[model samples]
Target: MRFALFSDIHGNLTALRAVAAAIDRAGPLEAVVVAGDLVQGGPRPRETWEYLIEHGWTLLRGNEDEALGADRIIHGEYPPRFRAAAVAQITWTRKMLGGEVLQRLTGLRESFRVATPAGDLLVVHSSPRGTNDRRGGQHNSAREVVDGYAGTGAAVIAFGHFHSNFVRATAFGLLVNVASVGLPLDGQPIANFTLATATSDGWIIEQRQVPYDRGDELAAAARNEMPPWPASEATS
Candidate 1:
């Protein structure tokens, strides 16, 4: 069986289209899963959410997605250093999405486990510990990376949140970050996704990058009057 996994779309329809085309080109995928961050932070948030809903992709909730249904932060719920612009974006996103979209976003699951020919695949927006686990993505070193999934039961842990693509192996199991579909922070202007094929012997994982005209996305963001910080997840 083959599975196509992508995450952190962040509401860029152009990038999503390019990734979809790439998936078609890579054809015969058993399933397509959007790990999280389907909406918020760019042009056409409604369109992106609708497209994902229409296509019936398996979805998970990201931090931004959770914020869509939440009230503005009054307490110290998030990082103390979190930017005001991000808070503003979340507020604007919640207003733009309205009640219906917020309901949809709220319905997304926090994680998913799939049985594959190779073994079990655990998919989550961040680490299995929870959605707010920063260590899952922002590991300081290789040992920290290995320690992040110390007790996960699955043979493979697939997650997205850091917007960087990497596959790592530890004594516990294998961890894969499928990266971002809309906003990649790896200094690359390309969209990314991962394909995992299970065989009798083991599992084969391939990361696919599709180059699309980011200028189009930028233009859309400008036309929508979205904040400039929406362009880059890492720097923003």
Candidate 2:
């Protein structure tokens, strides 16, 4: 099966559109997997979400999704490990979102699974174990990703959150990070998505990045009363 994996859209419609156009050019995909943070920070949170969801999406819940589950986030409730920046970002995001949007966000799952021609595939927003899990990787690190699914058996394990894309051969199995489709930590703002295909050898991974309109996204975020963040999730 050929599946498209995308994450951390963060309401950047231009980026999302560019990515989607790229995917269309790439051809028919078995499924499109989203790694969370569908809305919150960018040009059009609600609009971006509608496109991602209404189009083709195999979705997973991110930490920001959980925030929506709460009536109000108590500063003390956040983990001690979270940096001040992360906390501030969360504070701003909470206000930018409405109760209904939060309700939808809260309903997303931490992980997702699909039957592929190669085998069964698992898609996690952060880490398979938990959304908040941050596992570091590639250029940077984050438990929210690789570490979340320490022990797992699957033909391929794909996740996003770290914002860095990588493919690794681990003792567990074939681990691939589709990276962030919104804000890339590599100093590039282009979005990315991955297409995984089952071959006789095993799983073949392809990473693709799409360029979006950052100015439009930034404008949308500024219009919102929320904090100075990019997209969805606390990081947005």
Candidate 3:
């Protein structure tokens, strides 16, 4: 079986649509799953949410997605300094998403797991421990990454949050960072995702990058008075 995984859209509908087109072209995928961060950084929060729902993609909640709910103040989730901007953006995103969409966002799960012949595939926005775990990035050592999923029993783990992509194989299993679909901070300004095919030996995981125009997204940000897109930071 073949499936596609993507995450960190951050409300860029243009990037989301471009990635969807690419996925469609890839064809015959058994499933298309989103790791999270569906909204909370760009201009078209509602539209982005709607597109994902329309496609019926399996959804998981990221820190940004959780912030859109009624309990918007996520304590200890962000640095003390970035809290104000984070809260402001959350408020704006919730407004753009409106009450109904915000409620649906609140109901999203933190992770997802699927059993494949190769083994069980686990998907999370960050780490198995929690959605806000800081060790779920390329900045950490390989041992640290593998250690985070110690008891999950997932032979293949796929995730996205750091906006960068990498694949690692260890005794624990295969760890695939599918990367971001919209706000790609891995230097390449393009949409990113991962395609996993279950095989007899193991799963064949491939990282995909699709280019899309950002002019309209930037214009929407400006028109919506959204906060300036921050530089690549450790948080979220």
Writing each residue's lDDT as its tens digit, candidate 2 over 1-236 gives: 78888887766677778888898898887888888867644545667767876885777777655654553343243455644544566555555566676677788777778766676788887666677655635543434334655566676788877777888766566778887776677646578889888866678899887765566655665676445532233223
- lDDT assessment of candidate 1: 0.78
Best by TM-score: 3
Error of 1 at 149 (Å): 2.1
Task: Order the candidate numbers by lDDT, best to worst.
Answer: 3, 1, 2
lDDT of 1 by residue, 63-121 (tens): 77876677555323446565566677777667767788899797889988888767888
Query: For model 3, how does the per-residue alpha-carbon lDDT over 1-236 read when each residue is reduced to its tens digit?
Result: 88899999988788899899999999898789999999878788888899999999999998777767754666466777877777787887877877888888978998888898989989999889877777767678866876686678889888887788898776788878898887777544588988999988888888989988777776787787776535222111
Off by over 4 Å in 1: 73-82, 141-147, 230-236
Report the error of model 2 at residue 69, Å: 2.8
Instruction: Please list the C-alpha lDDT of all candidates, in the order they appear.
Output: 0.78, 0.68, 0.81
Q: Largest lDDT belongs to which candidate?
A: 3
TM-scores of all predicted structures: 0.89, 0.81, 0.91
Provide the lowest-lDDT 10-residue window in model 2.
227-236
Q: What's the TM for model 1?
A: 0.89
- How much is the lDDT of residue 76 in candidate 3? 66
TM-score of 3: 0.91
